[model samples]
Target chain A: MRSVATNSTARPDAIDERILEELRMEPRATSKALGLKLSMTEVAVASRIRAMEAKGILRVVAQLEFRAAGYNILALIDVMVADRKINEVAEALSRIDRVGSVTMMLGDPPIIVQVQAADSADLHDLIVNHIAMIPGVEQVETNLIIDIAKWRTGSAQLHPTSLPG
Target chain B: MLVDDVDLAIVKELQKNGRSSNREVARVLGVSEGTIRQRLKKLEAAKAMRLGLVTDATALGQTAAAYVRIKARPRHARAIAAKIADFPSCSFVGLTVGRFDIVAFISATSRDELVRVVDAEIAVMEGVLQLDVREPVGYAKHRFDLIHIP
Candidate 1:
């Protein structure tokens, strides 16, 4: 998989923003369809998409609603780790298939992760056997997400100004 | 809403490249384009899957991000989470069970904006008992895929 451009200072332009808006509405719209709607050639539209994707501005991806996908539980785990061992514990936790995201924070529980499990027993085992067993991990606090009021992908959050009316 | 092997296969293909045409995915998976199309429609209609753009916020200059955990009064967690979800700065707002009643992920263009949202907007809300903010210094992994269904 190609790595996202992290250091690029590029931002999407007006035309690019329009393309993004169209995609946001119809994520699978063909380039030909988009070009006709946007009054640009198919090639031009596709090229702009490629450019923005290369700049790490955006790329289409499939997002799952975990509950419907057979995952019964979603939880955030806050892990307090030994001093100077945050990165080590984080890397280990990230390797777990059940751990969806691992972020090293700047506080007491230096590592936080989003995790999913098939059920309560699965979640219990995951924490006790996988996460808590990681070296340097002192304490683990599990915050089971009961209901999601709102959740947006990073792309949606970044371009709120271009939201469709 | 039962997810079969075919549904998982289709989702896996789209997870890799959401823009992959039905014909392309069918060709790769050795299934008919109509089957692929039909499964995608079903999965989407079931709200089991979403095809959308995912971006790197750091590359776009929205570098400041933090996770705010809120302790809410009894029976107010859901309402507080709903209100917090409306904030432009919060990308995620959920009612959780643990030390905190609600948890939100806030992203802003700068650290000042992040702090302002946490202080002036979130902390001052009614029913808020306690609030803790944790800023991520680094990310070991942040996969968009929730889990490997297969």
Candidate 2:
């Protein structure tokens, strides 16, 4: 699996940022269409996109809304583990199908993960039967996401402008 | 939002390659281009899914990231969450239940930016009673493409 911290010194130029902005708004827009909108030739636009992809900076993918996809319960699970086995437990958690994202954090609860389940029962099983059973997992805290006020994906990275005060 | 096997297959296919043309998907799935097009239209109309570009912020220099759990004053959690969500650094803002009333995920260009947003901005908000920031030492997995379909 690819690490989240995949490094690259390459950066997008002004033109590339404009292309990304356009793609953010219309992901499926063809190169020819984007060329027309951005006043660039189709080959130029397509080549720039290809360069970004080659550099591992951008990926166009089908983003699924978990709640809408029928996995109603979304919870953040923080796990306290035996210090020596923290990495082992995190790796195990990452392999689980229900676990969405796993990050090893600093301090008391060394691991945190976003998990989804079809219902409360499944979530219970995941925590009790699956996660809790993992070796070195001393404790678990779950925070259920009740409502999401904002979930901007890739858009915010380019436009770091804050909302009006 | 009644998704069938075909819908799931289409989504699964696109999850692997979002830019796959309708004809390519049709060829792979042994279906007509029209069927692939119609299913995609239906899935999108229901807001079940969408094709989009996911940028690697780490590659783009936003290396610092963290999850902030907050305890807020009663009845103000949702409002505070909405405000927090508006911050450009915050990628996710959700009202949660358990130890904290709100949870937010933020990524910034540097550690200093992360500290500024969490300390100077979020902590000083009126309704924020308590806040705990957890910075990732390392990420074992961060999969946005995969989800439990069941």
lDDT of 2 by residue, B90-137 (tens): 878899999999999989899999999999999998889999988888
DockQ (C-alpha based) per candidate is: 0.51, 0.49
Cα misplacement distance, residue A104 of candidate 1 (Å): 0.7
User: Tens digits of per-residue lDDT for model 1 on B1-150?
Assistant: 567898888888887778999999999999999999898888878777878777667546688999999999977777788888888777788888888889999999999999999889888888999998889887787766542221
Runs off by more than 4 Å, candidate 2: A1-7, A155-165, B146-150
lDDT of 2 by residue, A71-112 (tens): 888899999997457888988887787887778898867999
Which lDDT value does model 2 have at A141? 93
Clashing pairs in 1: none
Instruction: Say which docking band candidate 2 falls in.
Output: medium
Clashing pairs in 2: none
lDDT of 1 at B47: 78
For all predicted structures, in order, the TM-scores are 0.88, 0.88
